[model samples]
Target: MNQPSSEGAAAETQSGALFLMAMLALGTVAPTVFWGLPVIVGQIAQQWGFGAAELGIAVLGEVFGMAAGTLLMATVLARRPLRITLAATIALTAAANFATPFAHSLALFIAVRAVAGIGAGALSGIAMSCLSYTKAAERNIGWLVLLQVLWSMALLGYVLPVVGATAQATGTYVCIGVLALVFLPAIALFKRAEAFVSAEADNSARVDVRGVMLLLGCIFALYFGVGVLWTFLEQIGMRAGLSEARVATTLVYANLASLAACVVMPRLGHGNGLRRWAIINIGACVASAAALTLPQTPDRFAIAAIVFIVAWTGAATLIFATMPRVDTVGRYATLSPGVLSLGFGIGSAAGGELIELLDARAAVGLACVFCCVSLLCYVSLGRAREAEQDALARASQS
Candidate 1:
């Protein structure tokens, strides 16, 4: 009897798999509530009478927890059932977010946010794993990026402001908690999507551990630069004399630019062009960081914001897309989020300290340095991969 080909089985499950991917992607970004916290950290600090360092500590707690969760998923939980993992993580995240509103002390707030991060990290790992199993990672990830941008626009541009305006930090946490609950219904779809992985060709090929490590290093450095800028972007704008509202408005345009990139990226196809695009994106990021260091005029700041978002989104999506190709088993893909989160945690704390000790310009300078380091790591990884492929071709020919 003829057996169904892997490609044929994949086609059969494509629609359901994509749907599950979308849910997981959405779950992946649902944790952006933590990202948004920096936007209102000033208000929280004033309410609590905490300094920049203290606020940073709180943020670091959540970031560490997220990294920890991702590490667990990539290692210990790697063999767990997707459906069970997703459900358990989402439930825990929702509970932590719900409790965030009640945290009065700095210690309590940090603890709860850390708890939320653990759950969020696990969810992100599951999402990345599922996405890695798909036939077209770049296109699917582009779609995921678009979903994330739209969600961010809605939450940051409207919901958080409106709700937080009335109830302050409490209102923000409440909205995040409620939003987390919305994903509970999506958990069931994971079961149906399990077939996507089963249908994949048995890639028993050994992974290039050293090469993947370099790539992960690049991811960490790239996001570290991003974390430095992103965590303090609004505050930096205000320091440059823009009103809070103006900063928010500028960020809206940035998000829009990111959305446009998401639309365009998938159409570009997954090919050698990915590396070229990555190079271009990193250059743009460095340029954006440099521009931010210039005089903070409205026009200059707005343009830089747009440039940063477009470049960052494109680069990040490419990294996510490229990881599956690097390690077919999705091991690196599972670890990518954790590595990026760890970078973010370190960058955020370090950026905050730089701002306090030196100035905003110093933080921007550090970000540029991180981007350059990332570029170097990426170039090395590319060379290693090319050599490996060439060697494999030679062996086959012989």
Candidate 2:
């Protein structure tokens, strides 16, 4: 990813607003298709004659692209104007995804997904950067959540049909491509001045590798569990005698809870909000693990789904919300998305492999352990802050 530069205009223009909205709209489409993959894997695999290993490889292609794009945006584009980067990525993803349904062979399809993955990765990074650049870092945080809500809404609308109608996957892919096209024009509209904020020339803050590692650890732990649960949740539910309709309803309920939380978290105060949200995320993970242990009846399933949603949404908000805060530490704000992408990649890889080994209940327990580690790290972080504050006060008194 590129770093923020001092050369760009100080304020955003109407063009930037349109650009942001476009990216947010397109962003949801890809992920909806992504999250819905597990529900459709059997159909896709059967159609494409894919073995488990082959299928996993295809998924990894996409994950690798995402990680690559995220790293590029964070390190390379962090210093550049975001509009250009955003437009290019959206265009690339849209084109690649549009070509996906027409692939004649599994290899062809995987190749298309690989390219699309890179595009999707860049799209996520650039979209996030644009959102952060819109105004003061503080205000952009709410805008960021709002962007997520919009994407989630789009995901909900697109995913339901894809899961329900076997015929919807091709059309869904094409539609996402079209959605990405819309961002091109919006990118043109964002004011040049508002596109890149200048940094202080004399500042020499060093990067906090430990902080970055900790934050990424948090994301990895959370998403890894989610990846495992999502890949097998429906399969497990069905094997346990759940009706397709009931299973679908459970997914809907979980996402709806997540949607509501995404909207609410950003509207709250800042300061310690990230810390509180981080703690909530750990709690959510524990709840989700507990949910998996419950009996597999409709009511129990519904409760479990709720726990999963709480955990999913809580961590997502905490991770993204804390992103800009890294700017205070060093060049991390520019590099954060890439580090995050790397974490997501690791999680996706590990999660996929883990789900293949453990039952859903056991998988959840393992995930909870990871979340507990994250909670301990965060709690210790808070204590360190308190200790620093006490020392500062004493020094001032002297």
Candidate 3:
């Protein structure tokens, strides 16, 4: 038998480690621009003379585009060089954002946002694929989540408000466009080794297609619940009689709580125990969604917001972390964002209709139902994994 040399193994590990860090940084920055839209939707509405219905339509367009882009990248573009594909996607995103400020009509605005979403979704898929190459996936994913939340807080709490006040909605779009351009230089880090990692992933155990499908379904349902509340979180606060400033402050606090959850996730590690944590988080999310139906008070609203953020963030982190471990080839991991984006698009559109027909509280109640369905999916996923393990063990004994 020919033994692999120690030096060769060390070099491979170093290269993989470098790719992991670079991917984390890219993931942290790219999505922040698109994710900041919800934070500044109020300013956009005022500037463009739109309302909740229009905003919901815009969000739906963007997330649907994201789903399409991620599907394309993971399937058709999967064999292409990672560096070139990522660079082109980022450049396209920058161009789309740059054109956003010139969109005078709602139709044009939605088109521009959809284009940007395509690029952002592809970026997210590539980043998740790269992270799946690392050995300690759960820990690194926790770090990725932490960095993303921190950046989101900065953009939402400080940057968007200042720019919106001065330049209104156009200024916010301009800032995001410029920020996208800044990431163009980071494309060089994608390197040839990434292709090698993707190739190695191809040789791993045969994909559990049924199991993977179930997991993706769960992810879709989970984010759908999140989107139902998130698409109108600010409006919800305002409806509760809170001032704009107070609502913004509440959002900042909620993100801070999410940040704290990310910080604690790595310490928990990965195991069967994660299922228990996920269940607990889902339960908390259901309670928070229920609380949104109650009468309006700043204190009650803030408490509910914090609880929702912490639980949702923690649950999402666990899901992302578990994907690479279960699939090992990164294909399912790459497609996770697509599933999530589709869910967001559907949830936002449906939530808007619910809010219009009934009330904000009614939309939240529907969200709680989605969360319960997601919980059932999680249980099914656990059973499937256990059965697979038992089958493999018996085969080995034979």
List ranges where model 1 is wrong by over 4 Å.
1-14, 17-25, 39-51, 192-203, 234-250, 294-302
Off by over 4 Å in 2: 1-10, 13-23, 26-32, 39-47, 98-108, 133-171, 189-207, 236-246, 294-300, 329-358, 384-398
Tens-digit lDDT track for model 1 on 1-398? 00112334333433475455565555446567655664567557655676776777887788888888878777676655566767788788889988887788889988998998888777776666566556676777788778876766666667667776788777676666676677777755544434223323324445578778888888899889988998899988998899999999988778878888987876664777887787778778889988999889988999998898899888877777777656655555667777888897788778888998999989988998998888788778788889988999999999
Model 1 pairs in collision: none
Model 3 scores a TM of 0.85
Please list the C-alpha lDDT of all candidates, in the order they appear.
0.74, 0.60, 0.75
lDDT of 2 by residue, 1-398 (tens): 21333233333242355555564555444344454555445555655567877777777777777777776665666556656766778778888988987875778878888888778777665555545544343345444554555555555565545644755556667766876776677665555533333344214443445556666666666666665565567765775578989998888777677666766665553566667866776776767666666667877777776777666665666665565544432234433344444444455566556656765566556656766666666666556567767998999999
Most lDDT-accurate candidate: 3
Model 2 scores worst on lDDT over the 10 consecutive residues at 1-10
Mark the regions of model 3 whose C-alpha exceeds 4 Å error after superposition.
Answer: 1-21, 46-52, 196-204, 233-252, 291-303
Give TM per candidate: 0.85, 0.78, 0.85
Model 1 Cα RMSD, Å? 4.0
